[model samples]
Target: MSPTLEFSFRIAITVDAPTIVSSDPARGKRQLIPILGGEVSGALEGHVLPGGVDSQFIQPDGLCRLSARYALATKDGTVYIENNGIRRLPSAFTANLFGDDMGFFKHVPVEDIYFKATPTFEVDDPRLHWLTESVFICDAKRTPDTVNLDMYRVL
Candidate 1:
């Protein structure tokens, strides 16, 4: 049987500038984008805590592998999340196209890119324990200064 997806929640994450670590021809470019703060809504409602970061490895071909860690504060308790995903640039845009200008990605058409992630949740509150057992998938869109995600639970 085919699995179905149910809408879980949405997170609108504000971010600061990305710090480019290094550009290696063999390994790719590494960057860290800081998470400032944001809001969550839908099935889960909360505020995203500050100080989290999204670490990225951009390959020569413009494929980005990203891992983001952050926390959410709800009325009940806090939920820790680790989301990992891949983003593929449009065929017309290559890694060399942006070069050292990582900010150029902010202008890319979000609809044209393949950006998706699987998020794992950890929570201490028994009331929110359902989040720990379910599998989640998220679709992400990136703006100039924010990253928005719509999360869905797999069933």
Candidate 2:
């Protein structure tokens, strides 16, 4: 059988407003999204401190590609996390402009977007040495102020 997956952890990432870097007709919309703070729960519990950013590229095909680099402090020590993913936002859902106003729209539920990410953890702490060599993937979701993720390890 092929290698299976094992639950790793869930990261609740807080964020500030995104800063759009550039709008290009051919390349797409470039963005630098600041990561404020949040927490990591589940198998590995920790906190996602501030001072990180998620770089996003919005394609005309409704797919937004992202490369997020951040740091997390686990019980073992500080671990650097690099997460890359893609998110699909339908035009109809994001047509209305709102800032953290998803709760008010009871008529529409959270956008059923296709979001997936591959996260790699780098740490020197012996307690979490295994994470450095592990292969992990995540299910990514985003709210106005937060990006919720559930990471799994290939086992």
Candidate 3:
């Protein structure tokens, strides 16, 4: 049987500028993007805690592998999130997107890129244990200063 997806929630994450950690030709470019907090809506409502980080490795061809770690504070309790994903852009837009100039990100058509993620949740509250028991995926989008994620549960 084919699995179906149910919309879970959406997270609008505010971010700071990317800090380039290394630029080795063989290993690709490494960067760290700080999470400045944001909001969550839909089934799960909360505020993203500050100090989270999104670490990325961009290949020469413009494929980015990203891992983001953050926390959400809700009425039920605090949930920790680890989201990992890949973003593939057209070769022509690679340099501008990954380079010091990120103005291109604002202009690129979302249809031309592939951005997706899988997120795992950890919560201490028994009431929120459902999050840890289910498998979740996310459709992600990137803006000049924010990353928006529409999460779905796999069933």
Candidate 4:
């Protein structure tokens, strides 16, 4: 008899700010935009891409939504599979991508940050496996500030 397959993986992403050049707000608060030219280290199981690079995402309205060109994995970090197609964030989400208090670019020193990720299929490549959507939040320039990993998974 054939055995069922289990897949999974874990990601450790280090996020930093100051990708784009911007001046402080004239009178209101300001938040730092994230730079995506960092390192992505992790292991994949079911369907995933071993090593891939992410691009800078800047929404037309000025909200940045970066896309990671990678795949999903199974539970055990053994089986890697490909996704059917791409995915995208709903218009509602993109409308206020950075405005969301739970998302990035919050000027407040939040004790907790939130993240959300979806999938897009516009860049379909057989070489890679599944595409994913992810989100995260971090404290704004606080001593105890940290980049939080809100979510990461195949969509």
Choose the strongest candidate by TM-score.
3
54-98: candidate 3 lDDT, tens digit per residue: 999999877899999999998789989999999998787877754
What count of clashes does model 3 give? 0
Better of 3 and 4 by TM-score: 3
Per-residue C-alpha lDDT of model 2 across residues 58-88, encoded as one tens digit per residue:
7755467899999998888888999999887
Candidate 3: list runs displaced more than 4 Å.
24-27
User: lDDT for model 2, on a 0 to 1 scale?
Assistant: 0.78
lDDT by residue for model 4 (1-155), tens: 65432222333333343333332323222233332322223433233334533343444443344444543333433322121211133444444334324333343333332233443332233333343222222112211223322223422
* Clash totals in order: 0, 0, 0, 28
Error of 2 at 105 (Å): 9.9
TM per candidate: 0.92, 0.85, 0.95, 0.29
Q: What is the Cα-based lDDT of residue 19 in candidate 4?
A: 36
Identify the superior model by lDDT, candidate 1 or candidate 4. 1
Which window of ten consecutive residues has the lowest lDDT sum in model 1?
93-102
For candidate 2, list the clashing residue pairs, or say none.
none
Ranking by lDDT: 3, 1, 2, 4
Q: Please give, for residues 38-128, the per-residue lDDT of candidate 1 as tens digits.
A: 9999988999999999999888777899999999998778999999999887867765433655577666888987889999999989988
